[model samples]
Target chain A: MTNTTHLIRDARILGGERADILLRGGRIEAIGPGLAADGAQVVDAAGAVALPGLVDLHTHLREPGREDAETVATGSRSAAMGGYTAVFAMANTDPVADTAGVVEQVWRLGREAGHCDVHPVGAVTRGLGGEHLAELGAMADSAAGVRVFSDDGMCVSDALLMRRALEYVKAFDGVVAQHAQEPRLTEGAQMNEGVVSDRLGLAGWPAVAEEAVIARDCLLAEHVGSRLHICHVSTKGSVQIIRWAKSRGCDVTAEVTPHHLLLTDDLAESYDPIYKVNPPLRTAEDVEALREGLADGTIDVVATDHAPHPSEAKETEWCHAAMGMLGLETALSVVQHTMVDTGLLDWAGVARRMSETPARIGRLTGQGRPLAVGEPANVTLYDTSAERVVDAAAMASKSMNSPFNGMTLPGRVAATFLRGVPTVLDGKIQ
Target chain B: MRHLLSAGDLTLDEATLVLDTAKELAQVGGRSVKKLPTLRGRTVVNLFYEDSTRTRISFEAAAKRMSADVINFSAKGSSVSKGESLKDTALTLQAMGADGVVIRHSASGAAHRLAEWVDGAVVNAGDGTHEHPTQALLDAYTIRERMGRLDGLRVAVVGDIRHSRVARSNVLLLNTLGAEVTLVAPPTLLPVSVRTWPCSVSYDLDEVLPKSDVVMMLRVQAERMNAAFFPTAREYSRRYGLDGDRFARMPDHAIVMHPGPMIRGMEISAEVADSPRSTIVEQVANGVSVRMAVLYLLLSGSGSGTGN
Candidate 1:
């Protein structure tokens, strides 16, 4: 492995002035123009784009009980394929990833998977029921060194619970990733509550249900003066609230998934289970607002709330099917399509949203570095101009549940390196 | 291998194949092992974006019995609540290597869209009120098991006709099976174009009851009540509810039915639901068989006409 390691040239190093990057002993040993290529196995990088390994703050590995959906190994492989070097695994698995033991189980599995650095996010409340706080210190002290905490599947609905979780994580400098949606307001909500709901005759999942929670959580974050990370921030109001919070200098950060940027509630008219998302796809205005947030940095990171389901659950009636789509395989391409191809933002923003900022938010220090010397060899090489249609059959995961099938994508991840090892090369998992 | 996304696309022969295969699956469902290797290596995802107890658990039990790896994905508990789009979740499921997806959504065409997006087969559980094709299949299965045939039998679907997916599907299916379909409901309960239906409309339930072979009642969704669709539940039930009086009015061979979780006295009297001529509980049991058939035929086997 050491003898086969080498250097790259003509790469657009994100955030780095130098175009050359040298890798030796799992870190960039040198990065400069016209560096010697002697005794090195060289990988040509003429006209290819390089980004710091991406980071995801919200992802469900579904281990402990639902490992069949995704274990750390499979999920890490997905992250690698999506050009992610680190991801904060959500805490809503069967056992909830609430306790130190469960979080440790997740940590060990990520280590065993070895495709990416899986940061275990301990639950804010035991079982994520929003009733009681979990042992934050114990999880942070565990081998995984959990730094990001969340009640992802469930919001810490109790105001006191949210406050307590925020203050508690302060001990470990942990950021509380909140899944915003008021518990009582959202029960039996099958679709986004508005014109679509009235038209479809299904119960409405009101946007206010999410926006209200974001508003409440922002206030709580401000009150406690503790860092808060909003997971999968949807809609214009939530973005506005987050923007206000950040302007007030409150320690609040937000993420918007790739789908929110590209799709909207019009698809709901189809009454298709494939478009039945949680915070159900909002209006086109919301999509535009999310795009603007992603472009101008109102949204801090682009995370794949990568959730997988068996085909049976997803195949049922619209009101009975699950509400998620697999995202890791197409996150970059989507960000590139909706943000870059449209020319709203440049490669620097792509690197920030996909790579650098997520690492900072999740506290993954070894990741999100410019491709250069003496930096941990975490890099994603891509062809910014490639065009290909996405097919679930060709993807690496066991599930073929992607919504991008047959849709042409203009961006592609060509190679990814994790600790100086090529986990992916030529668009194939190595 | 999983995810029943739509009813419109399935051929009649294909629909019957699922019904027949479900009959085979029912025999083995209660065996000591209570499992099969049919879907052992396969992964089935239960992706319900809406609130569902019968449909969700039915699919859950069906997949588990087939020995497929099952992942229960509840939207209430995922990032879906935040702002993650359905497509993102689909990509995530694809990345997890889901071989099959059983989905129920609130939207009308969600399942069809899913079929377009993924590699697995699509099964339309129900998309909006446009169709609940499987419910029709199951109801037909129950009718076939009891009435011996579908040709030329009179079946009256009563109450909340406009709001009931079950009614719409049953009407289409029963007429296809050669049954004389009559939709009995107040003018308010009928769709905007009830006149377009091949079936007859009866405002007089008592008049329609004596002539019918199957008096199927639809659950009156209370949520739709605010629209003044009907005068009141009491009035609606008095006119359309199946009680001993209505049961006695029907021909001796006529059976009563409802696609269930019946509102009890609201849809039918307790006695009628439990009557010899009533097939409500049998509907629940047949649901498994009907669903098993849908899964079996959709996943691997031929359509229902083949004896096998």
Candidate 2:
């Protein structure tokens, strides 16, 4: 454990007033101009923007099964480098994180890794089969204390099962994150169902397939009085549904991925499998709508949905390749480029969408806290002016399937502090 | 010139040159000595991941007539069936000194990807529902031969336009040749992006049939239909199918064409397919000459004198 104090000098706190922060005993002791503390390691952050550590509501740390693609340790390191203090690990692993034993094991692995808090999301259904509900109460009461339940790689498509999963999560204040896709409509879908899919001869995944399930679940949640979360809302139609659902005071929230906000389905024109993803990148108009949704309050947060896959899985023809792209390491950079630099969101808004809202939606504690005294010192020092071309090979994740490779994105995480302990220092993992 | 990956890759001039060359080569097919000495030492490989006996034999015959060595590599019962990747197969062909590789795969853009891996010229014989450039060339040649020109001609492509690689190639090539093309199919059979294509679209084939110079019927594969693109075969035959009644509605000089192995009773009737105005058989014969021109131009380069 880190028992020493840290003195972060001359940093813009929350992109506001320049101040010095003194961390002692794993909490911010003082925040003021020219703060001095003896026997503390000094971090010179003159031009850096200090904000609350980011949290991801969706991330697939592929362990307990697909180690060739990613493991908990590697994914955690990637998260730390991306300035994330907590990540909700998805439940689509080999044996699937349905039981309390598996959830605790993943949680224990996260603790051992010591980079970030890996909150294991328990599978809503046993083995993610979508036929029967898993031991939701048992997983919530376990040491892992799963506060989020999902059958993410596969949607909980059955209406009865989805309603039941939503109802069951209310007992423990758990949120059921729905991967909103109708299975039959997306059976042979290779990309977004529009002009690009038509041109490429790949099967289309219609926007209605996602919107239909979301519209149904929102009504189910309203009927059952349980909190619902939508994972990776990719279409304008989905955003409209979520907005309408929120208008009626249904306890619903939605997230858009970094890739979906910036990339479009036109990238699939190259027939490159690297651009292939589930709920595939949509059109430019959809991208604009998603951006507007986030800029307003329609879309609640930005989740990485940081899926990782090995080279062989993504190196084949588009139809034959596995679906997913690495996102954890480049998520913030993409956000800064797409949202902040475009003048759509300020740094405070960035903290709200990336850190506060996601943590509140996932019910994560000791995260999404403001940079104030007596608060937990989970802080990220970012250089907003720094620009770097993304190189997938240089990423901390084991997988190099990032769609953002070679893209010039703004901002860089200079350092990250998890409870005053430097997990990433000077852009490198400690 | 180096690769025939798409019909869009050809300009009007290059397409006309290929058509003119095919016309010259068609005469060679009717001669007592039906062989050319243009590509004596060149090797052409037919790498087919999807089975297409018609396209494979046509390319083999084209290469043989040009006096080029030909190798037919079918994916079935081959190393490709043993999980060998397209890259490995392409590398193997590159090592074997293939001068041209004509590929037919079930995946779109397979030939384009193979072109990046090999040093030889790549020809997309048929790649999924993406494009079949030679078929387009042969169709254009037939249209020009029958109608005397492609400029301002009204060409109506009927049936499953969504799944027809032949229709896609023809639309692009025919558009480049200054022809006004119209796609006639049910809304489900038409691609959602058909509006972006260089052609107009109509749901009524009867309306389009009456005002066309050429009616090209794309084969409707019953096996490829997993969902109901149309109500039934009988209903599709009644609506979009080309029968003698629809044939009689066409202008006197208008021709009927089918990229053959036609579903005789489905997309076209037997009588309409065998009519004197039907260029179905001639399309097959012209396919060899067009492919021969493609193989010759790709392997020998444009400036090379015909080594008579």
Candidate 1 is graded, for docking, as incorrect
Best by DockQ: 2
As a TM-score, model 2 comes out at: 0.97
TM-score of each: 0.64, 0.97
For model 2, how does the per-residue alpha-carbon lDDT over A302-407 read when each residue is reduced to its tens digit? 9999999998787667788899988988988998888988999988998999999999988877899888889999999999889999999999999999999998
User: Which portions of model 1 show Cα errors greater than 4 Å?
Assistant: A2-4, A15-18, A269-272, B1-308
Model 2 shows how many backbone clashes? 0
What is the Cα-based lDDT of residue A180 in candidate 2?
90
Candidate achieving the largest TM-score = 2
For every candidate, C-alpha RMSD to the true structure in Å: 12.3, 2.1
In the range B12-115, model 2's lDDT, one tens digit per residue, is 99999999999999999999999998888888999989878999999999999999989999999999899988888999999988889999999887887788
Instruction: Give per-residue CA lDDT, model 1, range A244-301, as digits (tens).
Output: 8888888888999888888877676665566767767788899999999878778898
Share of the reference A-B contacts seen in candidate 2 = 0.39
**Model 2 lDDT at residue B239:** 92
